[model samples]
Target chain A: MGSRIEERFSETKAAGRAALVTFVTAGDPNMEDSLALIKALPEAGADLIEIGMPFTDPMADGPAIQASSLRALEAGQNMIKTLAMVKNFREGDSHTPIILMGYYNPIYIYGSQRFLDDAKAVGVDGLIIVDLPPEEDQELCVPALAMEMNFIRLATPTTNEARLEKVLTNTSGFVYYVSITGITGTAKPDPDAVSRRVALIKAKTDLPIAVGFGVKTPEQAKAIADSGADGVVVGSALISVMQGHMKRDGKAASTMVPAVTDLVRSLAGAIVN
Target chain B: MTKSDLNTFRAGPDEQGRFGIFGGRFVAETLMPLILELEQAYEAAKEDPAFEAELENLQTHYTGRPSPLYFAERLTEHFGGSKIYFKRDELNHTGSHKINNCLGQILLAMRMGKTRIIAETGAGQHGVAVATVAARFGLPCVVYMGATDIERQKPNVFRMKLLGAEIVPVTSGTGTLKDAMNEALRDWVAHVEDTFYIIGTVAGPHPYPAMVRDFQSVIGIETREQMMAAEGRLPDTLVACIGGGSNAMGLFHPFLDDKDIEIIGVEAGGKGVETGEHAASLTGGEPGVLHGNRTYLLQDEDGQIIDAHSISAGLDYPGIGPEHSWLHETGRVSYVSATDSEALAAFQLCTRLEGIIPALEPSHALSHVGKIAPTHGPDHLIVMNMCGRGDKDVFAVAAHLGTDIEG
Candidate 1:
């Protein structure tokens, strides 16, 4: 286990509650409001933060998260800005585990070794590149794990028992069980099925299992937590809150950060209780 | 990197499916298992003689294969240099070489017991091919096409609809071929249980590029045989236009090991590569990952995919197939570009001289042929793949030529 992710999961276990892992684009609308939202997430009760490094083509994301990435890129978000955002977030808060997630092109262009070294220097805890599976681990995952940054792997419903072992081999962080087989925030995942899949994953490794993809509201998060997951991830739901506060010119409204934090607070409360 | 061991350029993609540094299974975790399964199924089908026999039968009876290799005598006389021949893949059943891949993949999909079919297209030739295969197989088909392409290639759009395909107009990411492919991938992820995505070209992940190339290699195989019978010798040169490089790879792959056969691939130079408005990935782009493989991509310094522009919708993609990237890097094939106006001039010349109105995609190749054919001796043989007919492009061509025609 890595440092911040391990400590956070241990704390959540001792607290007898599932951790609320909130996700948001690093530069959605603009960099300033995005930073404000990131700074406010931990105080609103997010135990872990997954900052999306925007790419031009986000294949695995649904419409909401896809829109957020486009908005970020349009606002001049790049790998450098994203890492700087993580650095800035680390200054305000140190306990929250920051995981950068997205496709791998920008990072590949940014130079893999350089990006990983910079990310580790600036206090990034983990990574969740959706495109890099166990087959292509040599590309980035192996290097990231060596950096003491948890290389999180997403195990989807399509991942059979044989393939699950491969997914868990080099995974340092918790196992992210994509509750649905589809893209993010598209379909609703059944709590019972998610519970069964969580147990299936937990039987393989000691890594805590986190349920994501289709987790939206407080009730859904609570239900997933009750299903024995160590964490519940809410991404498109939070981005939808930010989307509601956007102006005509495609910038975030003044209420965007606060509204997103408010929803995160409610979701965190539900998961904790 | 040893030159002595590098004997055959045909043997590629190793076990991890990489050609040099390009081409790997870079997809979301949800689709990895499916890709592996498809790879397994394709390997099995390759070994099964029954599968080969069925495919061959379909190729002969269904697709009207062995498309003629005609000598462009008038154009040869006009050029007054090299003797020119055209491998008329445009004479295939769907009027394009896309049916060759669609038929092969649909057979594989059926062998895997997939109940539905999905595909992405730019000029709608591939969409029409997939829809035709799905109709023949009695499976539900969905085609994701860019809204801009649907507007321009309306005839092919109607043909896909007429074949009972659900045409989903994709509006994201500049509304072009790349966007359509993205949407198709999303749809495949959501419906991974029973859907088989028939990637239109030689660009996708591992088995896709290899599999599509194998399926379309019939063009090159037939060209070799026909050229031997017609001229009693191998052709000196092969030329084909590349969008996602399917037709070019089809005609080029079988000849890659033939060291003496010079090969050329033409990319769409929309307004010339210098203007930064072209789709010439090899000539004007750098290596990056997109659409499940690492290849030469038209991207900015920040790695954002810059939208490509070309008058022909089929040639207006930002990236080429990974194998092409390998071939380009290793100097196995010469990559060049032809501008829109040049292709337009070639389109008119081909129609008037050869009495074959070639599709705008292959017009890029013909334009290159016109450039170099006159420089070679009359004894030299030049064969170009006429990959598609111009029936689908007549409206666009007419509009480009400043002529108004009523449908």
Candidate 2:
């Protein structure tokens, strides 16, 4: 189980340049489009796909991200629907590792161990619970490890050396280095600042580091890759792209895979070594 | 219970400030420095007699202290079991117990010289309360709310807006109370030095739970004096529905010394506890940390918090206030549940029977009142904290039960 996550990390690293990680709110806009966007991610040059499990209160999100979530909820997104979306993704592909990212409520309501087993059964390789910290990791991290699911920890810029050591202790998957200390979709951090944090984290662990929170453009991705991080996790940027191309014609909204795929292709362009 | 034995009640946290199996500052590092600063500042303020005097002055002058202990003569007859009395917090300046804490926080913020106040709301009651206090203090205010809540709780949102508060509609996640809280936290982080996060409940990190409860203690203090004046005795049972639980704590604290007075907290059981749709923390939770303190929470095996669903927005949280957690563990209070259907039935019953429309949150307690009053015998008196009125809930209730407002 440990080796599997490590291997995924190794594969991303072997590519030498950083891997583009794309995040889409599950059941956002609509479930059908959300699933299509998931399928198109790999072809769009995304090595990792982060699917947001829509929560009632994503405190870490900005207005745009919040609006995207409302649209998803309006379209009727719930735990059952989110799990179904993952199951559908598994039916078509198995190579591109899927990570379920969000706050803890949906997973809590779904039953933690039950959610973990279900994620594993349906091929969800990793989880980035925005709110869960190392001091309280015993609740989910241990159980996730037992189920062979990777519990990724988000190490923020405010994390001190002592706190970072504690946060990284036996943490699985990759160290999710939040580029900034603020919430999601607010603003991008200086690539130099993110690289400094990345260099600091690399000195402590053998685990691959993925930078997230405000890494929107290709330039931002290239900059983070230049800083020695393993991957870039882009959530709100792609969510905005999907919202932009969504037919204003008020007609049947097709799945937004094509536009998101184009955006992913552009993101990959930033990673050309 | 002993004034001299304060150490007995004092549960020391670790080097990191954790209580005995509870009470730690579990916040993001962005807020950690602020939280730590708050800890030190709170310690300093707690020792200041001037701060205490100011809080007392505000309680008496601003909030209309000594909120009534109204005896429900008809309700006692309707139950035909125990005498029923209500702590009329619904009559408070903002029409709820939220102002008790809000006044204190606003004062503290003023003393700290913070320029702005930020708060989060689910049902919008807390937001309204904060807005009112901010208005009184002449401080700029902002409130974050989930989009779903803003629509359902439109009247309160409008009320806040009218009070000159800047409303930020959070469209994130399920766009409920939790999302509102998260957004408020982000806002606090961005503007920590100049802003005060006035948590509405007796939850959150150190000082907040303690501070809010101290401010709300007036409820218990007044209830004690009022009960003594009217009945020359403390009632046998005290009831209040728990949200962030400041209201319940206020009513329950005065009776803590009277061990014979049964303390009960009613939790919102949305559909039913069996269906994963309630906020009945004390009845179904283990000790876990959320918002800022260690308490009873609705979490999965992974310890991630779940979004609680209750017919009453105030009670729809995956966690309970921390003081309730202490009370539950210490066996000082009893915790119970009332489902959405049950609470609604109680809400209608109260309005029809007593010409009073109880908030859905309190209806949960009222529903439990029916169950417990009969078992305690007709002589036993049960005094409940009627935390707020049902005006905010009429639209939601009408839509949910398919009952017309005109009817």
Cα lDDT, all candidates = 0.93, 0.79
User: What digit string (tens of lDDT, one per residue) describes model 1 on residues B14-67?
Assistant: 898899999999999999999999999999999999889999999999989899
Give one digit per residue, the lDDT tens place, for model 1 in A161-259: 999999999998788889997989899999999999998888899998889999999999999999999999999999988989999987778898889
Best by lDDT: 1
Best by DockQ: 1
Residue ranges of candidate 1 with Cα displaced over 4 Å? B1-5
| Chain A superposition TM-score, candidate 2 | 0.94
lDDT of 2 by residue, A116-205 (tens): 888888778888876666655766778997777888888887777877898888588888888876778677788888888888998998
Candidate 2 lDDT over residue span B81-122, tens digit each? 888888988888878889988987887787777899999988
Each model's TM-score?
0.99, 0.76
Q: Please give, as one word, the docking class of candidate 1.
A: high
